[model samples]
Target: MTMTMTMTRSLTGAMAAELTSLRDRVLDAAVVCVDRGGLGRISLEDVAAQASVARATIYRHFPGGRDQLIREAVDREVGRFWRDLAVSVRHLDGIEARLVAGLVEARARLEGHALLQRLLRQEPGDIVSVLAESGPAVYEVLATYLEDLLSIERLRDGVDRREAAEYLARLVVSHISVPGGWDLGDEPAVRRLVRRQFLAGVIDGIEPDR
Candidate 1:
């Protein structure tokens, strides 16, 4: 290739790598901000400082500004959540077991998440939009697992697995959004209750029990 073409290819590769690193840094910074002060108080300066980048760098990656960055951060976290859940549910047998396990895992993970716990404890309502947008993705993951379990007749015959998964996903999302005052004393108990209640609902919906 010509000298100009070679230089152009080299610059393009460098730019791509830098952009990827910048995106990862931005996401990490967002997690730190939410952990430290919740979403409402997460300043762009704080994110930049946490990421060790100039404030302008954040704008370059996410041009919609702070709100946009926050949304991206939330979306990234949600994506991680779904990936984790998918892995956890693999190889589990019964629909009810998978359902309960998934719900419990999701609740514990989300509620116990350092950043999310801080946000829920402090700002409370600020993360709702992000959480809401992520709900459908969670629902799909749950549905796939439920279908696997139900197909094997491990769950009740008439269960609307899709609806059930969506309901539990919403329930968990809503529960975490509420400000529980950081009295994590009830976290374990609440998780147990959620598991029990969710499993019971599924069992009851199966057949003669409903």
Candidate 2:
């Protein structure tokens, strides 16, 4: 009985891992196809051939067909971006350091994402439509994430954790969209901006722990 249970657990784990692998392959292929051509132009056959998987397997995993595959692929890539952003700032203890790290990381990821840029350039309307639906949720998620990090921060007397977090989130979103004068990828400039203007409004002063 013990052996049976142990074997059952092992098989379950292996199956789950295999499923994840299969999903990743298909999503990667879908992303590449979409990158090469726009979403409207990419077909299920293109994804299948690129992924080296049968169309039946893709349908089994993504029953909604090509639409589902593309949506999930985009979501996965966006999730990966946020995860990387979180990791980039996790070690920093101070608000200033955290802000600088986050801004730099976010910009770097944005600049590096080829498919994201291609979609934005070639299919602006589609990207805008998707952002219209997902932007608010993303804002909330970033605000919550910032709230936890900034709770211990020494903010201005009138400022609270929630307010500070939301403020930073708004700034981040704006800066990423239209970083006209400031350079987010420059660590020194970002740190300077955070110290001089960015946090000047929220906190009287913050010397992020070195």
Candidate 3:
């Protein structure tokens, strides 16, 4: 009985891991398909073919089939975007450096994604809805991530960590999507943006540089 129970637990864990793997692969394939041809043009069959899995297998992993696959694909990409953004700035020395690098990285990723650009151009509502759905959760993540500011000396006087984080998160999202003057691709321009606009509001020291 004991041996049987142990084997059963092992099998269960293995099955769970396999399912997670399948989900990840399917999500990746769906994103590729969406990028190649907008959401309206792709179906579960296309995703399955891209993933090298059967339609039935996709359905087994995603019970709602195409709809669930598409939605989860969008969510997964959003999560990936944030994770990539975090990793891009992790090795930097200071908050300002990290912030500037993060801005450039984020703009590149956001603008470089073909699916998102296509959606924005042709099916604006779909992408907007996904962003709106993910916004609050992402804000919480950003707020928690920015808690590092509490220990830093440059944080502006009388600013709470949460408030500062929220402010910065909002600004980053908006500016990345619609950066008016600053060239996010240029390091100096992004550095000036960090010092002039972002850090100026949240950090005490201000250096006038152009």
TM-score of each: 0.65, 0.83, 0.85
Best by TM-score: 3
lDDT agreement of model 1 with the native: 0.68
Write model 3 residue lDDT over 21-60, tens digit each, in one string. Answer: 9889999999888888887777988899999999999988
Error of 3 at 35 (Å): 2.6
In model 1, the worst 10-residue window by lDDT is 176-185
Query: lDDT at 73 for candidate 2?
Result: 78
Model 3 TM-score, all chains together: 0.85
Q: Over all chains combined, what TM-score does candidate 1 have?
A: 0.65
How would you encode candidate 2's per-residue C-alpha lDDT over 1-210 as one tens digit per residue?
999999999999999999999999999999889888888798999999999999999999999998788678777776777777888888988777788888888887788777778888899987667655666777888899888767777777888778878888888888876677989877788887777666776776654323
Candidate with the larger TM-score of 1 and 2: 2
Stretches of candidate 1 off by over 4 Å are: 1-18, 148-210
Computed on alpha carbons, the lDDT of every model, listed in order, comes to: 0.68, 0.81, 0.82
Better of 2 and 3 by lDDT: 3
Q: Which stretches of candidate 3 lie over 4 Å from their true place?
A: 1-9, 208-210
**Per-residue lDDT over 1-210 for candidate 1, one digit per residue giving the tens place of the 0 to 100 score:** 699999999999999998888898888988888777777778889999999999988888888888888877887888888678768977776655555466556656766777666666666677766677766776676566555554555444566866666666565555544435322235455545554555556554442222
